[model samples]
Target: CSSTRKVPSTEGKVAFNFIQINDVYEIAPLEGGKTGGMARVAYISKKLKSENPNSFLVMAGDFLSPSVYNSLKVEGQRVRGKQMVEAMNAAGTDIAIFGNHEFDIAENELQQRINEASFTWVSSNAFHKKGNSQQAFAKTDRPVSEPLPPYFFRDIKSVDGMQVRVGFFGIVLPFNKANYVIYTDPLETAERLYNTIKDSCDLVVAITHQSMEDDIRLAERLPNLALIMGGHEHDMRKQLVGNVWILKAHANARTVFITNVVYDRGSKKIEVMPKLLEVSEKIPSDSLTQVVVDKWNRISSENFASIGFDASAIVLEKGEPLDGRESEVRSRSTNLTRLVVKAMEWAAPEADLAIVNSGSIRVDDILTAPVTQYDFLRTLPFGGGLVEVEMKGALLRRILTSGEENRGIGGFLQYSEKISGNRDKGWDINGLPIQDSVSYRVVLTDFLLTGGEANLNYLTETNPLIT
Candidate 1:
């Protein structure tokens, strides 16, 4: 009997592929009646998975926040959080991370959504609060007061006979003591996890909601990290540092990320290819996911259909920059910036000058009516209130200097019509040769007044901006 020896396919090598999508804040249909809804993401995700059986899908945090339906109720009083979980489940997400806004809901509610999630929920820096003696808002999985795990791992089989192991870790910005119960630092936390699991897994991916600098630093330090998918800054691109590939998708589900990596056994090296997928008309919406999204849309409309006027635009579309320092509404500057400035002026009259952080101006489009209170709320939905800070010329200069140095997209300080800086060329803002040491009273949001993330050289003077 001649026995034919077959070549053993069990070489110590494997080929694998996976997809990552970030900053998909809104799963439902946007107000403008455009797509990029959960259904569309679901459609794309299903197609990708079908094409590559070993394919796994992951969301790099910011899946929920600034959403009209999500903000309507707290403590699970309304079921929007549950609905989002349902949509995520239908979309076939294998894992998801957390962004800062996930805390928009209380601890209990956040846990409920996590428990309801069909896939794994992770936030490397997210901490759970222990329940009060009374156990108010307590649930079975989480005590009223306790921190949660920062990472999760899954074993997925590849098309070939190779088994691939993937590890996912998440991290959000640390909440200030006033707001957070237990805060976890992203860098420290990531290091701890990486040290623990570096050898156990074939690949480690970090889901972060941090600034670009923060992500870059992490990639530099973590040599074993395969991918760094993040948000928070809402930058739309893929960057590589060493062997680690860093990616962040635009907010509000406007775009998603698709990353590919090939593992070669001969070289014992893995090559990464990252692509940004703009959520556009080309991709069809998944029918199964659409059913869940439609419900959220109807619910959002019912609750938030009464805040702004129906206008041509809710956000300023991409175009030319506005006049240097003039605060004309007609300027094609950011609509959200214009509105926030208007709101501050209306709310705080005493302050002669008004300014807001570019980051605070989150809404990408202008608000048109049939607009929900939810729309306006989501526009600047961070619970931060309006504040009038006392500042003189010197302080104003310091704030400006700080803003200018900031590398973040929304770090620039937007001023109102009353104040005009060299008001014509972008050069004035981009080219401040020296610090101006003049004193001027300025209006700033509570976020800036507190000197949160960005460093503003300004010192406080007197009046507090209204809440």
Candidate 2:
């Protein structure tokens, strides 16, 4: 085994590999089994580890929630990311961090998943809320609950006998404000943790679940750092901010970023090379990990059967791919988004128009034909029902403006064919300008009525302008 290899000195230099995937939700291959499978990722990680003993598989977060399996109940208890933890364990995942969606499940369920994980978790800014006090989230598998560490470090020796200490710290975006979570300032937490561990380790890395802007700010704040593996964005991206490299892979294990690092001990210089690899049918699945994935697939099917739906039943078959990719749906209206809005309008025939937030559509893949009931479940895992609201045009216009400004983010709205117009030109419904005195009947997701959407908190049903 590569782990048993002897180390030989190579004139004060060390090399290692980091295989990173972020914002993964599904364990099976998506898009007609052509792309994305945790088992395929496992094959890549295992292959890399066989080539280099210092290889580490890192998940940058968002694996637990917003998945079809997460909504399923098995044996009277919610699956709640149990399948993901089991697959990751079998895949040999080494390290991970928390994403905003990790808090989507109940606090107890989140703790249970943490306890089930075999990998190390590092979180620098997030904490468990204990009344007024804050504490690290803990694993309860042991007799005593062990708080997860703020940072993680590992000592690695190259085949040339050059020893290096690598350190990692993780910070999540404070987007999801779960009652049990307390989030500190990510920048402050990162700087403090880096200062604390930098001296002890030759290299330090960050695993973050935040916006690209936030990641850039972090890179600028700590220009000496070598790399930042990020999540929350469903697209793959890489940017060099000063000497540091920021990398993110496509969501749902559709792709992975492999970062190769070489450090010169004498000169204290680090070199990073990042490669984005597609996880497709071309790559073979790891047998052991596939077994775990298949088990979960069976559970998911069984749950669907119990709930009176055929998991494998075809919902629709389209020749062209439905564009539900995150970047596309959040920024502009796509066919899939239009279809969803039309469905809402059909469900509420009396409503003047229908609107849905881009975030409501979670499957970030361009789904191909033969879309199954399972695909629909994955697309809208949260499964909120449509709600009709009566609100004055003045309030409706304000809500539309808020959604317009939220472009590129989840809060952006997808409107039915009846609505059109832009900020400068003004919004219109069915070719007529919105009149402030008119009361419009609008259909939207029930979640939005609670004023939970970004920058639209005043849109609740209790507002004077809404009924």
- Model 1, 1-467: lDDT tens digits are 01111111235555445566666656754545463567877887788767665566777766556454554543438554677678889999877767766766666567677767767666565655565322212224645533334655666544454555667788877743424345667899899998887777677888887778899999998977988878776547578888888887766666677776665545656677777787776678888888888776666565554334322224444444322111222123455566668878888878666777766544554344445444555556455677665444444555655565653445566777554453232222223422344334556777776555455523333323211
TM-score of each: 0.76, 0.97
Expressed as tens digits, the lDDT of each residue in 353-462 for candidate 2 is 99899999998887788888887788889886888889999998998999999999889998878778877888899899998989999999998998888898898979
lDDT of each: 0.62, 0.89
Worst 10 residues of 1 by lDDT: 1-10
**By lDDT, who's the top model here?**
2
Which regions of candidate 2 are displaced past 4 Å?
A: 1-9
Q: Which candidate has the highest TM-score of all? A: 2
Taking all chains together, the TM-score of candidate 1 against the true structure is: 0.76
Residues forming the 10-long window of minimal summed lDDT in candidate 2: 1-10
